[model samples]
Target: MTDALLVLNAGSSSVKFALYEAAQPGEPPLLAGQIERIGDDPRLATGGTSEPFGQSTDGHAALIGGLLAAIGDLAPGDVRIVGAGHRVVHGGARFDAPVPIGDAVIAELEALTPLAPQHQPHNLAGIAAVAAAYPDIPQVAAFDTAFHRSQSEIAERYALPRGYAEQGMIAYGFHGLSYASIAPRLPALLGPEARRVVVAHLGHGCSMAALLDGRSVATTMGFTALEGLPMGTRSGSIDPGLVLHLLSERGMDVDAVHRLLYDESGLLGLSGISGDMRDLLASDAPEARFAVDYFVDRCARAVGSLAVSLGGLDALVFTGGIGENAGEIREAVGARHAWLAIPPPLAIATDEEGVIAEATARLV
Candidate 1:
């Protein structure tokens, strides 16, 4: 039987999976799929076929079990899953590389939950579920925060007190696996001009990074994913005083404010219609137009700011869902920086699963 690697990217509402030949590094996945909407109206899509799940796949474990069963049915009988790689959102200050899953590593990741409450727990749940099902299989965690570890200390620091900075309240950029996936392909795409590049990873959770010679020198995200550009349902970087005002003057508690910024803000709040960029782009409503305009403005501003960090812009690479699909967004953001005279922004599809699979294969 041919050995295979299973890669899992578990989000709050969905788990995306892919299987690759363990002996093949750059080959395409043997099978890829996602189980979306975990708690509400679940659906499974694989090999271009989409269908509602017949079984009750309520939690991460059940959903993953169902996914495994589906893969077993679809995969060639000669294929054997030898290892699993996971996309973990936060690696905290301790981990800067892919690591083998162990009790100690799991506990350390659990301590980082408060740093990324929306993602860390769900990621851990996926790891737990995989362990329960494939007790002997080796699993490796490839972190989204690990790529930014190459960034300098000054770029990662906050202006807060020394004590706070020492306490891990510094900027720890996210969307790293995406950036990691794109960095290697740059030299081929841009050649010598790839020295100073700013990659905008615009999706439901948006962020940008300044890469100097393929290394992350600066990024938009901070200690949390909420610190970057305004995203689908996230407010991005809002005034800290506004949060305090909600807590005190508006009579809202921390939990209420959290829900507001994390779930009720961004494009959805701005348009009062939908958080999906596809929806906003299609709508003729003034609010929708304004939200789109705002998103583009901030994106351009981020490029300019990141350009400053790179000393100048050699290339601006766009990836992630919105960046890859939205032509109007790319055009508008590019037009704002037309003065730079750089070539058009390059759109590269990210392969976090492939990166995870490679890491898992190497470590295992």
Candidate 2:
């Protein structure tokens, strides 16, 4: 069997997988599918075409089980899954680049749970299961932090106590992998201008980066993923005073605060309908439009802020769900910066599966 590389992005309700031929340069993804609603959907494939590879009561386990079975059936001869790549958010101060996965690494990742409670635990779960499922297949973690390691201390430091910064409580940007995938492509696609670029990664989890000379100089996210533009369900940036007020005056606890910031904010919080950009764009409701506008506004402002960091903007690249498919969002964001000598030319972010495939190939 030709060796194959599998890329997994496990989310709360779904497990999205992309199967790529382990080619030298990672050309294309051959197969891609997702299993959704673990216990509720009770089906293997999101569309219900396949049986549940492994039934599960928990969201994380459901992804692992479904992915295992899918790999078993893909009889891509000689093309067994020789390498697996996972997207892990918040590698903290430890890992600022993609690295091989192992027991010690998994434990370290587990230790950073408090850093990214919503994403880290589940990400580790996928990495661990893939290891157990195919002990021989090399598993690698392509961090969302790796790309942002070049950020200057001014861009990464939190205005908190010195000790907190020393204790790993400083800003370590997310969405580095997406930006990393787009940064190098700029030189080929945008010529010399790609040297100074601002690429917006907009999805359920959103962030933007200013890449000067192909290094992350500034980004939208801060000490935590919570400090960027409002995301699907996350409150991007909020005054710390409000959090303190909620705890002291309103008597809200940490979990309560987490619930509101992570689950009850952003598009869902503003629109009271859906967090999906497509859904909001399709709806005529004022609330929906407001949510859409807010998302675009924050993104536009972030572009301006990062542009200053680069001295100017040469081009703009959009990735992730909303950035790639939401043409209106692209047009709108580009228009905001039309005042610039050259408005950032927008393009579809390259294949993430291909990026991971290439990363794994180099290591394994």
Best by TM-score: 1
TM-score of 2: 0.90
Model 1 Cα lDDT, one tens digit per residue, 322-360? 899998898899998889989898889888889999999
Clashes of each: 0, 8
Best lDDT goes to which candidate?
Answer: 1
| Model 1 stretches astray by more than 4 angstroms | 37-41, 54-61
Off by over 4 Å in 2: 11-14, 23-25, 35-58, 74-78
C-alpha lDDT of candidate 1 relative to the true structure: 0.89
User: What TM-score would every model get versus the actual structure?
Assistant: 0.95, 0.90
Model 1 weakest lDDT span, ten residues long: 53-62
- Sliding window of 10 residues with minimal summed lDDT for model 2: 39-48
Clashes (candidate 1): 0
